[model samples]
Target chain A: MGHLILRVTIKILFAPIILFAFYVQFHGDYGPGGGFQAGVILASAFILHALGFGLATCQKVIPPNWLPAGMALGVLIYAGTGIYTMLFGDNFLDYDVIQPDSHHHAGQHIGIIAVEIGVGLAVACTMLQIFYAFAGREPEPMDDAW
Target chain B: MMLAAAASAEVGSEVTPSTPEVVGFTGAFAVELCLLALLAATAVAMIRMRRLFGVAMLSGIYSLLSAAFFVALDAVDVAFTEAAVGAGMSTVLLLSGIALTAKVEMPVSRTRTIAPLIIVGVTAAALVYATIDMPGFGDANAPANAYVGRAYIEQTPSDIEVPNVVTAVLASYRGFDTFGETVVVFTAGLACLLLLGAGAIRGGGRNDDGEH
Candidate 1:
């Protein structure tokens, strides 16, 4: 429980993991990763902290209350983007009409980024919530007492 | 087909006969074969292992191997997801689940095995049969490659102007489906919260040494 190596390694690795997650999120348009992968990567960093330290410490960093809201807000952001385009007289999720000022390709780029952020938020929060649920449980005592 | 392509590339020091494409395919085939062998070994070990913790760890290894296979198959996005979700998170979650319950599985009754084996065997045979009719992997003439897949590939560069066609298709072309996926994730989180209802059965057994 008091493994210094694990603690130190996690502390060193945590920031870089989150940074890579952000890179994966934004660079997805030009690279292999996207929101789903980025989100899971982000959540894994937090989960690693939870594993090395305790659940309480992890919860202090990412309060349980924030998770559900973050999950909903992400979905809302995605749906809201679609609705915004629709209100602008575009078909559902038709990114071109969202910004009349830019070229249609530019508009598509903007739309993709916006939605990817939404997906990232939702997936990350969902993973954390599931982790909290499982990790927070109290294990029952074993039988065969002396 | 990929093997055939690679084999046809004559190896000559003076000629440099292997095209880049053929060399790439050959490298991919080797990587895939290695990963598959590791995956099979991990699965066999998992089956032989009785401890739930060991099984959980083996499954994580299996996921990592499959992620490598995904990379060899040129599905980097899928590889990324598999490595993160399947290897990273699910293993931790499974260990937690094991912690809450038992570390070892109960021995199964001998009579209960036959029906399940028959069912699984038939399902496997059926799946293998189905694959016989399916097109060879990466065949351009395949039905999957014919219409929608072809359209996505052809249109993504011009229409979305993105280097990553997977992201362009997922977020832009199929935005509605992705929106649905986000909602599904949201609903799953909500369901977990509803079922667990944060702060249930507090301060029970052992105090965890670090338990709040």
Candidate 2:
């Protein structure tokens, strides 16, 4: 029951944070928010969860073993966008060249969004992984337990 | 020819704001000052704290306030990066390091601290003197604004089609720097993994039954 209450409280806190992260990601073009802010905000939610629920439960949700893979995948996703642009016959990171149609503006938007998502994923995962690496050490069992 | 073209480009563009813009500018300036004060307080706290956790938390606050200052300065991308790398990732890593070592930082000795104090004093004085000759905050016609920024703003849209100036500067004009930063992050991760060991065994040991 205590765990259930904690889960509900976390859910309530998490919903707004996720909303803010998305806002930072998309609204960055107009204001002082962007991929980095979104990534940190998203990572903070997980960090808070880990702090409250113990590292073990947090690991169940985001296993430490998969963190490096997630980080690498995020970087690959970001770089892949530039690679895609190059493959499409433009210079690296040339968004317009990726699609090269009348709706080139749309292409730019899509490319930017894709790259931001990649950044957010990489940052969030790396942060959580770091926390796991540091706080994950188990306490030695007491001999008296036997 | 290239020099003439560059000179012409410099003269053609400048960020001249109107009356309402001035009001907005003043508002931003006030916000920037408040954030700077907050950052200073955090730095002071970090320096004064003997507990490692307190110092780590203060450093995170410093990062967050610096991010706010960056936003006020219209460097959104930098603000974002600082908030993530500094406040989010670095704090976590520091705390992790603390977990491996002592929670409380050793108190500074009166005997050993004099050298550091003198060094800090000298550095601060030098920085203050350097700032005196700097162009006034947000001077659109300053050399930094006139040369590199103007060139990028005018030229990058035609080339890259991205509207965000920070994005253009980071991913296009100074792309190599961004790549280097990414490499640094990758290296930090590698170092943590190597020094700390595998992620699974970090927080605690698993039993023979495989329970964490």
Give a tens-digit lDDT track for model 1, residues A42-111.
9999989988998888888888778878898888889888998999998888988766677558889888
The residue ranges of model 2 lying beyond 4 angstroms of the native Cα positions read A1-9, A138-146, B1-38, B80-85, B155-163, B172-176, B199-212
Instruction: List fnat per candidate, in order.
Output: 0.72, 0.31
Instruction: Report, for every candidate in turn, its global Cα lDDT versus the true structure.
Output: 0.78, 0.66
Interface RMSD of 2: 3.9
In candidate 2, the residue pairs with backbone N, CA or C atoms under 3 Å apart (3 or more residues apart, or in different chains) clash, namely: A136-B203, A136-B204, A137-B202, A137-B203, A137-B204, A138-B203, A138-B204
How good is the docking of model 1, by CAPRI class?
medium
Candidate 2 CAPRI category: acceptable
> Per-candidate TM vs. native?
0.87, 0.76
Kindly provide the TM-score of model 2 when superposed on the true structure, using C-alpha atoms: 0.76
Off by over 4 Å in 1: A142-146, B1-27, B200-212
TM-score of chain B of each: 0.79, 0.75
